[model samples]
Target: MSRTPDFLAQGHDERDPSPWLALYLDQSTPLPDEVKAAWLTDSSSGSRQYLLPFLRPVARLTIILIQVVKVFVPRNWSHSKLLHRLLAWGLKRFVSPEANWLILRHFHLGSQVLGFIGRNSPAPVGTSPLEPADIDALKDETFLKHDLNLFNFVIRLNQALRDKGLVLGKAPQVDFSMIRDPGLRLSDMPHGKLNFLDLQSAIELFTPLYQLMLTDNDFWRAANSLQLDETIGIYAATLLGAPEHLILVNNKHPLVPLSTLRAGHRLVIHGLSTEMLHSLLRRMQAAHGATPTPEQPLA
Candidate 1:
């Protein structure tokens, strides 16, 4: 059999992949094989496949209910402190600790991705130098209500863990700072709305729903603010040394309600596991130069 091309291999004329992919594939920061296997299994599990039939109707109903609510409540009220507080209350009371840890771990991974992009990009094409303060700014309500949700989830999860005689080795922290906006916008890029016909675009559009749940908004906004799309474009064109396949473009994709519901259920069901959560925290801690405590485990 012909050897599979290394998409991440540098100096290759035909394949150039994102450095962010390297973060997951590199030997120095190895992801556990079992965790990867679990992700694959969860993606195609029977539970997820069977649940889709029930979830589809519920998802359609949810869209209708949301539209009805929007008519009664102004869009601004969606971000109101009152509504946030209520949501926070519900999350605290109802969401599993495993899910909260998974949610927070995503922010940490996002910070690492953005930070890697910022620090590695060539001069004149990179983001402004990020600082500790810039990372902290991610938690401010003005910047993203989702970050506040992150904080709330962290506190509640930690408390729950403590009650169960477990502790997270490290709480999620942003490691990069942006002194100023990178001024890149997806709207300015040649990208189009996601197109379901393109498999990659379709996956990108729906992956966020399962991975970040309700917290993806701020990450995307932060990505735009940091000019990640543009910066990645530069890396694709200049750094990865391939532009033909590496350049980013927005694609339009139609959302099939049934497909979305199935994808969401599949991802959420298999997304969280004690091993995966702990492994992620350890990876984050290692990236930040902290020692991973072996005894620390998620509840």
Candidate 2:
């Protein structure tokens, strides 16, 4: 027998293979002598042959269906009282004891064993971070999907703030020259950057203007305004359009519903303190029939 199995020799990262990989291995890779012997000993009462082909495509299909249901049904719907009752009835009537046993032992137990082995395995060394150019390229591709340019919006907002005679307590952390200059191309603008001060400045200027526009309030005549507050608000919520660094979900800030968070929706509460913001979030959640809990993740 070959000392190194094909599964082990596969050019996967030295770090643990995923749960899916483990399932694939369980089907393809031969079991160790100890494991087979243990299975034989455990199967004294029932014939071992009866439990043959435990890792079937049928089992995988069942698991996949469960995942699809979870994905299509929003979390709130799944947790609803009516759905809970239906789920209980469905599981009891539809799922058999033998099927349950197979799921518990063959699928769950095997996956747990694979997970343990993977966790204990050594990680690969010398993996470098993504290059700055690569990061910039990704950002540019992402930004192309949206209509507004975030950096330019920020620079325009700063000018609006100055015109309005609003003095920020601190100067913005982001340099606006690259974006403010019409001579520079989009590629020449700062890459993969998001300064909090710049973000706050954009929020400060854009949100109030947006809210006013939403209400159709009379402040539609400011001299230095770009007439693009709606555009700025739309892009600001996505702010960098990077999921890993989302700002709207921050616990300290108010959460905005993505569907309603676009350009024209009500997104601002002028002079709202941090405490007031959290209070408003709870009220909003309650009004929407979503139970508010401290541990619940921001939407």
Lowest-sum lDDT 10-residue window in model 2: 174-183
Candidate 2 segments whose C-alpha is farther than 4 A from its true place: 1-77, 80-85, 124-299
What digit string (tens of lDDT, one per residue) describes model 2 on residues 1-299? 11232333463654866443344346232333323222222232132223323323333344345445545554433222332244223323333222212212222221221221122212201111111222122222221211123223345445655676653232222111111101112222222212111212222233332322221111121211222323222322222222322222232222322322221212112111111222233333345455423232111
Which prediction has the highest lDDT against the true structure? Answer: 1
RMSD of 2: 26.2
Clashes of each: 13, 0
For candidate 1, write residues 1-299 as lDDT tens digits.
11122333333343655443444355442346433322333333343446445545665455445445545554333233333344334333433222222333334433333333333333211212112222223233322443343334334444555676753232123322221122222122112222102212222333332223232333333222322223323332332233442222211121211223234333332223222323433454456565533232111
Alpha-carbon lDDT of model 2? 0.27
Which residue pairs collide, candidate 2?
Answer: none
Best by TM-score: 1
lDDT per prediction? 0.33, 0.27
